[model samples]
Target: MQQSNAYIIIFSVILTVVLGLLLSGTSEVLKPIQKKAEELDTKKQILGAVVPAEQISRMKAEEINQFYESRIASKVVNIAGEEVEEQDGVQVTAENIDVAKNYKKAPEDRLYPVFIFHEEGNEEAANAYIFPVYGSGLWDNIWGYLALQTDMATIEGITFSHAGETPGLGARITSPEVQQRYKEKSIYSESGELVSVVMQKGEGKDYSGEPHKVDGLSGATITAEGVNKMLKNYLEHYQSYMERKKEGTPKMALN
Candidate 1:
């Protein structure tokens, strides 16, 4: 009852083609849904920089999108702090720019996205400015959104995420308790020097009296160092834009 070799080969080819087409069709069908989910997650993270974590967690996906659209405006800026209408002929906006991909490029060549948070009805004045930062963690990539008050020096809130890090240790960067510790922290000194906040060597120490210091993770020294470097690096990257804004320069209209 053995089938001929030619019959077996033909049957295998047909099965392979059929399976490939099914997978391709399924992928095409799911692509948009996957993209929407990714977009929603990004919105949630950006909102987390200013909104309370519990509030964000409680909101539905549609509500999150509505809130983001009404309160957030954004623009892309270059390393020199100039508003860029396009990059390499592609019109890039803050929402669409891939911060992780840009992180792979040289600092001077990367496109920086600034998100401006205003009241629901007031777009003329900003309440806070959120900057996205990316860098290495103990095991993989770590990133966050840092929101500054109107003065553009003090942190209003922050939310961190990582690709791969030890749970209960480095991954604690995403904990709301950890992020809240950065609230009201300053990234500049009294003399106007850009001295970004630092996560000291250990945790449980009091940094309340310190403007530019935060308590580090107890057992994740490497991850703490990663966060410190990310904060300082991105703050410096955005320093020129902040200085211009502080100097009464005209702001660009949101895209």
Candidate 2:
């Protein structure tokens, strides 16, 4: 016996709806796990700014959370170096402030998230202040965090992540050797100016002994330029926060 066309159509629709519901239910059930994984990844990236990527690789999720919770303190500040109490009627905090979203807002209105890291036992003396930055690269978006030492002028370290930079070239920004070049670079000049790091072309040497110059990718000039611009743009956004720290202001206290 052959089934009628109408009956076949009805069966097909029922099967499709059942499969769709099953898939949706599975996704819903795994939503919490997915969110936890994302949070772990973010913590890893933030910690990567200061800690070596290899070291971060060895850390467990609990270790990351413990380190971030016990050693690192987060604060939300405005362009004027003032700690924000509330924004749009919601309390301002580091976890809630979206740097990418704030990037699109007006310069003065943007909210900045500053993560201050300290040694395990020393909370009073901050080791570094980490800032997150995002920008367009040669092929896609590039982002990373720059950690400035307590002095607020010298860079302690940095980490870069790109969406689709060419392999072995612009992608090398994430390589240990490339990121190490930024370790001791100073963002401030002798005259106390905000001269963010520069990625020079062709062996990218600081022949002039410039404090803020770093070696750029040999053939990936566009991506290198993107890193340079991204650093400057984000650093300038946090200038007020750094300046306040430099002035020994008591506005930001460790939590």
Candidate 3:
């Protein structure tokens, strides 16, 4: 019995060491692939919101990189629309930016990244804000930016995508139709009332009183509900930002 017990203890220790080494080795081997995939996926998501998928699909990776670098500056801006202050002052360059694992829980030294999607020399430049939007979806989360029209309410161009939504159902939130709906719809009224986006079960009515309410998906009721909630929350989250942007001209430098 003693001999058997001793053998068992020895075998357990050996097994633990072998399993630890194997796991460590496996993690090291897959680290590069994992990192590359994450970077690629992040680029794809950001690009999807920056340019239409069709536009990106037609271009090569290098083209995408070039176009991305030229039009959009991947910089971090605070919710207040200020250049995120860093160890120096406000960070206008990415080099001065501090990196973080998660934007929601970024370190005190790090600025939450809000990629500026801009069109250079465009007349609409006057209206641009460091437009940032984020929200929780059914399965995970969804977020994006809006290079909205100068009116502070009208959407000029929008790029959106989501994360971990059920494949066909909840995933439709990323559809072009969903993304573009904001273009024709009004998020605010002329009376200065704040109107949040909504998703309905049946065909929605006219735009004046019903611009926000979209048709909720048939099967994925929960996802539809999530979309509605996400839009409402994220829009509210960026209320201060939208209020700070210009309506007509490049409103005399930001206060």
Candidate 4:
């Protein structure tokens, strides 16, 4: 039997509305779970800056959060490395800080998140300082956490992620091999200048012999350069904080 056009239109409208309602209801019901999962994912990424490559993927969400809370001290800092108590009366914390949002603001106005990982029992001193950095990649945004050694000049580890980079090329930024390249690299010159680590062509040099240069992805030059720029810009913002640490200042060290 052939349906009349009016009847078909009515049926289509009802179906569309029903489907839309169902989707909306599902999203609303799952919103909390989704938010929890996102929080867990961010925790895992932050952990990635400290955890070993083999263990990062194997750790559960609960374990990640446990380690994060116990071993990490998070705080917000301005460009001058001073801890910020509140911005417009809203407390600034590591979990609450939106680094990407702050990036759009002026340098002094930006509030950066810093994660200090220390021994479980000793929160007074940091073993390393992990910083959050983000910038444009080949396709979209790329971001990561960079862990600096207690000296606040050498990189301990890195973990990068992207919104949409080509597979096997720019995407290699997240690979263990690529990330390993950043380990032990120096981000400052001996003269106290902020000369961030560079991504050079080809397999590059042994970082132990050449501290500031690393092997970039073979075919992902633009993405590699993006990483370079992102690191330099973000690290510069923390240089004041780092200098204070080197001088035995109590801003980030005591808390």
lDDT of 2 at 175: 91
Candidate 1 lDDT, 1-255, residue by residue in tens: 449998999999999999999999999999999999999999999999999999999999999999999999998999999998897797888999999999999999999999999988687678899999999999999999999988888999999999998999999999999999999999999998999999998888999999999998989999999999999999999988998887653344333
Error of 1 at 197 (Å): 0.9
- Report the C-alpha lDDT of model 4 over 169-245, residue by residue, as the tens digit: 99999998889888999998889788999998765555558889998677889999999999898888888888877
- Residue clash pairs of candidate 1: none
Per-residue lDDT of model 2, residues 1-255, tens digit only: 349998899999999999999999999999999989987887787888898888888888898888888878888888888888798898888866776687778889888888889878676678899998888789998998899988898888998999999998889888988988888889998898999989889874653466788877899999999999999988988998888888773545433
Per lDDT, the best of the predicted structures is: 1
Best of the two (1, 4) by lDDT: 1
Report residue 159 deviation for candidate 2 (angstroms).
Answer: 0.8
Clashes of each: 0, 0, 1, 0
lDDT of 4 at 50: 84
Candidate 3 wrong stretches, greater than 4 Å:
1-16, 29-33, 87-112, 120-132, 145-147, 156-163, 203-210, 247-255
RMSD of 1: 3.4
lDDT for predicted candidate 2 compared with the true structure: 0.86
Q: Candidate 4, 218: how far from true, in Å? A: 1.0
Over 4 Å off in model 2, which ranges? 1-12, 204-209, 249-255
Candidate with more favorable, higher TM-score: 1 or 4: 4
* lDDT of model 1, residue 91: 88
Look at candidate 2 and tell me the lDDT of residue 214. Answer: 83
Per-residue lDDT value at 171 in model 3: 84
lDDT of each: 0.93, 0.86, 0.59, 0.87
